[model samples]
Target: MKWQNSLKDYQLYLKIERGLSKNSIDNYILDVKKLIDYLDANHINISPVSISSEIVQQFIYEVAKTVNSRSQSRIISGLRSFFNYLIFEDYRADNPLELIESPKIGRKLPDTLAEEEIDQIISAVDLSKPEGERNRAMLETLYGCGLRVSELINLKLSDLFFEEGFIKVTGKGDKQRFVPIVDATKNYINIYRYQIRIHTNIQSGHEDTLFLNRRGKQLTRAMVFTIIKQLVEKIGLKKKISPHTFRHSFATHLLQNNADLRSIQLMLGHESITTTEIYVHLDRQHLKGVVEKFHPRK
Candidate 1:
């Protein structure tokens, strides 16, 4: 079968059966496309079904030269998933990546801001401008609720449950979770929604969208990054940060203050407690304090 046909079928399965997002399906497709591009560039005429492990290995060898170990590992993993899909469909007998092993890479810890740093960044906003309140509210929600940038951008008006002190969040694979929202976060959001947002002429289909661009359309992920970038630069902060920094900070701060990992996991929408354990590692000093404060021996 043609490589294109195989890839098209795989994307459909990912979307329909696996329930992968468009971004995820696109990434998987890119992995296969890289192999196809390599074959075409080398003038090799073998079809996907007829391709050998050696050729795939050669492509990986070439990929290793240009990317870091982490990225190389991801590309290899993507290709492995594609081949596994082929095997599952009975189009191919085995995975080309069966014998291949990923390189040893450390789990890089996420960066976080302290309370003061977060405050300074928010304080740096020019409240004189019309967008300032929106910016402040967005940053507040980001740090307060520990939201992913995608989740923040996709937040809707109907999702707010102020009386219940919660807001609905749509996470990875479209899983919905109701995260607690404090009055402070709700007040900030209300300032934007009631004051600034009311004046703007929202675009069609974006009326429910919580955040908007100058055109009153839904905010993009890139726009969120850009907003954080400008804020970091304005505050002259040295640490590299993104919209996700607030999320990491939210988890880290909670852990340091003696909040349980399971509760933090629920707040962060992490499927596993292990994912939340990284914050525990970040606050060993706090753990030591806990032992010193409450232990009977002390």
Candidate 2:
């Protein structure tokens, strides 16, 4: 089959069967496209089902010169998944990348802000502007809920269950979970909603969206990143941070304060407890405290 035809089918499989998000599907498709591009550039004519491991290896060798190990590893994984899909569909007898191995890279720890640093960033918001309260509420919800940027952006008014003290978050793969909301976060959201949001001329189809831009439409992910970047600059803080930093800080702080991994896993909407265990590495003191408190030898 043609590369494009196989890619189209792979995209559908990723979306419908694997339930991957658009961003994920796009990345997977991009990996395959890169291989197709490489073949075209080298004057090699080969279809997806007919491409040999040597050609794929040559493409990877070229890729290594351009990208870092982590990114290269991701591309390798993406290509592997694509070929595996072909194998599953009976188009190929085996995955071409089955014998390939990803480069060994150390687990990169997430950057986390201290509690005081978090306070400083939040306080840097200029309350004089009409969007000030809204910004505060958005930041609060991001940190307080440990929400992914996508989840924060897609949050709806109907998701807020204030009386029940939990907000329903639709996470990766459209999986929904109820995250406990604190009084402080709830109050900030209320202030923004009742005072500021009510005055804005919300556009149709975005009426139920929890956060909106000045145009009365839903806020984009880039807008959220820009908001946090401006705040970081205003505070004169040197550490590079994004919306995800607040999430890392939330999970890190929780782990530091003796919170269990499983609970943090649930709160962070992690599909695996192993994902939450990274926070354990972030807080060595917490682990020390645990050992000292409960270890039989201690």
Candidate 3:
């Protein structure tokens, strides 16, 4: 089949069957497109079913020259998934990249802010402007809920259930989870909703969306990144952080305070307990305390 035709089918499967978000599908397609582009640039004419592992390996070797190991590993994973889909669909008998191994990369721990630093970041919001309250509420909700940037942007007015102290979050693969919201977070959200959001002329499709830009449309992930970047610059903090940093901080602080891993897993909507265990970034003092308190020999 033509590369484009195969890609279209792959995207359809990702959306309809896999339930992956648009951004995720785009990245997978981009990985395949990179391979296609390489073949075209080299004057090689080959169909998806006919492409050999050697050609794929050549493309990967060239990609390694430009991207770091982590990114290279992701590209390899994306391509492997695509070929696995092809094999499942009977388009190919086997994956071309099956013999090729992804490059080994170390497990990179997430950077977390201290509680005081988190407060400083939130305090950097200038309350003089209308978006100030909205920004504070957004940041608070992000940290309080341990939300991914996508989850934060897609939050809806209907999702808030303050009376029950829980908010419904639609996470990756369109899976839904109920995460408890603290009264403080609820108050900030309520403040923004009643005071600020009500004033904006709501857009047609995004009326139920909790957070919006000045234009009333839902905020993009890039916009969220930009907001945090400006705040870090304003506060003169030296840590490289993103919207996810707040999430890391949330989980880190909770773990540091003795919250269980399983509960954090449920709150974060992680599919695996192992994924949640990455937040086990406990310091030496906490580790020592745990050993002293719970060790059998102690």
Q: Pick by lDDT: which candidate is best?
A: 3
Segments of candidate 3 deviating more than 4 angstroms = none
Task: Mark the 10 consecutive residues where model 2 has the least summed lDDT.
Answer: 278-287
The Cα local distance difference test for each model comes to 0.91, 0.93, 0.94
Models 1 onward score TM values of: 0.96, 0.97, 0.96
Which is the winner by TM-score between candidate 1 and candidate 3? Answer: 3
Give the better candidate number (1 or 3) by lDDT. 3
lDDT of 1 by residue, 1-298 (tens): 9999999999999999998778888998998999999999999999888799899999999998998899889999999999888899998998889888888888888898989999999999899998899999999999999999999999999999999999999987787899999999999999999989999999999999999988999989998898889989998999999999999999999888878899999989988988888876655676688999989998
lDDT, ranked from best to worst: 3, 2, 1
Better of 2 and 3 by lDDT: 3
Q: What's the distance in Å from true for residue 178, model 2?
A: 1.1
Runs off by more than 4 Å, candidate 1: 294-298
- Of the candidates numbered 1 and 2, which has the greater TM-score value? 2
Q: What is the lDDT of candidate 3?
A: 0.94
